[model samples]
Target: MSQYKINVTKLNLWYKDFQALKDINLSIKSNLITAIIGPSGCGKSTLLRTFNRMNDLIEGVRIKGEVLIDGENILDSKIDLLSLRKKVGMVFQRPNPFALSIFENIAFSLRIQGIKDKKKIETFVEKSLKSVFLWDELKDKLKSSALSLSLEQKQRLCIARTLVTMPEVILMDEPCSSLDPLATLKIEELLQYLKKDYTIVIVTHNMQQASRVSDETGFMLLGELIEFGPTKEIFTNPKDKRTEDYISGRFG
Candidate 1:
């Protein structure tokens, strides 16, 4: 039997009176990349946030159904959000590194979790940077300001920061959107390397990106999941006409 890292069962959400998600159901496999693709306002980001309860930061947001992580319901009142976020880190559409040094940005997350060993932080910082293929370029410059790096480096740094926490699942909301073609390809390569150890769920606007990076793909339209299956199957032999139309560039 396949082990699921995340299972969304009849998940629904509302931002005040406006319904954002309608009965979303998905099984995110362990150590694989699951891509969410859709047009604007299609509830892709909202659904991603549900895994770590990021949507709760917004006022008037309501949720129904359950998001199960490792068989534990994340929506329950007793869930520890801080611990949950540490286990399920998120990278936003744009790279938003802190003004601190690259090393500090990665180490800060560890410190906030109450880690105080200097040698451990240093060792893990190098490991995390190397994990994302950023160590050779940024290793000697660990003291440099994170804001000084280019867009791609910053994105990788953001990813490295998340990885330093040793999260079980990484949630990315259009993580490559702010990068150029070469940079985007690099991030995609990093994702391929990452999936060997961690489950990754990405929300992407680019169809090519979804097909290239995902093991499974889910298509959403107007707050509903239109079709979902293997990446090739979803892109090629979509069972739903709506999915076919969107995949073929007819309408999104």
Candidate 2:
């Protein structure tokens, strides 16, 4: 197997005529957390969506170059988009669990996959919650509505839902943006455990959060990837002048 899980080469994107990404080239390591950081409109989320071709949902969007996941080019127009999305599930900035019971929220996607075995679905639900450390707290309240849970629990449950399909990669787009400091910390710790089993790519505006949980960090600005390297190197000794300036608190 290759060392990199997602390989993006010469990738470019535009919304109508407004270019959102400019020749982005990045190699995300398998089973590790990679964080994309930048100011708003710098293409952090745009770059994240490219990994799974999520940007294709928008009308008048033009894409260039390659996004290879496990040696297969996902950008190929003929590829199975549904299967690609399943393999690369995403967690949005805000927790958007369904208005259904906790159990049903996790089982909803499985139902779409035609899994009607109740007992088997229940087993996978518990396992998915356990993977995100929510099983112990939520097991007794499996029948409760997902909307009744705390913000942190909802976010964790969203993550659990993503795991239910057994995806190879999880794309998190500013997942902690709506959480409090304590809740953000919990999600950060969860990412550490999750990295053991899944490759993660996150777009975070919080520099501290990126420094805390990421193995590698990429700095993007004005639709260009300014610098990408080991987190420590990017934080302590950035080679690019713009990267150093951004990290030094001079400017975003």
Tens digits of per-residue lDDT, candidate 2, 108-183, equal 9999999999899999999999999999998999999999999999999999999999999999999999999999
The local lDDT score (0 to 100) that residue 113 gets in candidate 1 is 77
Model 2 stretches astray by more than 4 angstroms: none
Candidate 1 residue pairs in backbone clash: none
The residue-by-residue lDDT of candidate 1 on 48-117, one tens digit each, is 9999999999999999999899999999999999889989999999999999999999999889878899
RMSD to the true structure for each prediction, in A, is 0.9, 0.8
How does residue 149 of candidate 2 score in lDDT?
A: 96
* lDDT of candidate model 1 versus the reference: 0.94
Candidate 2 weakest ten by summed lDDT: 243-252
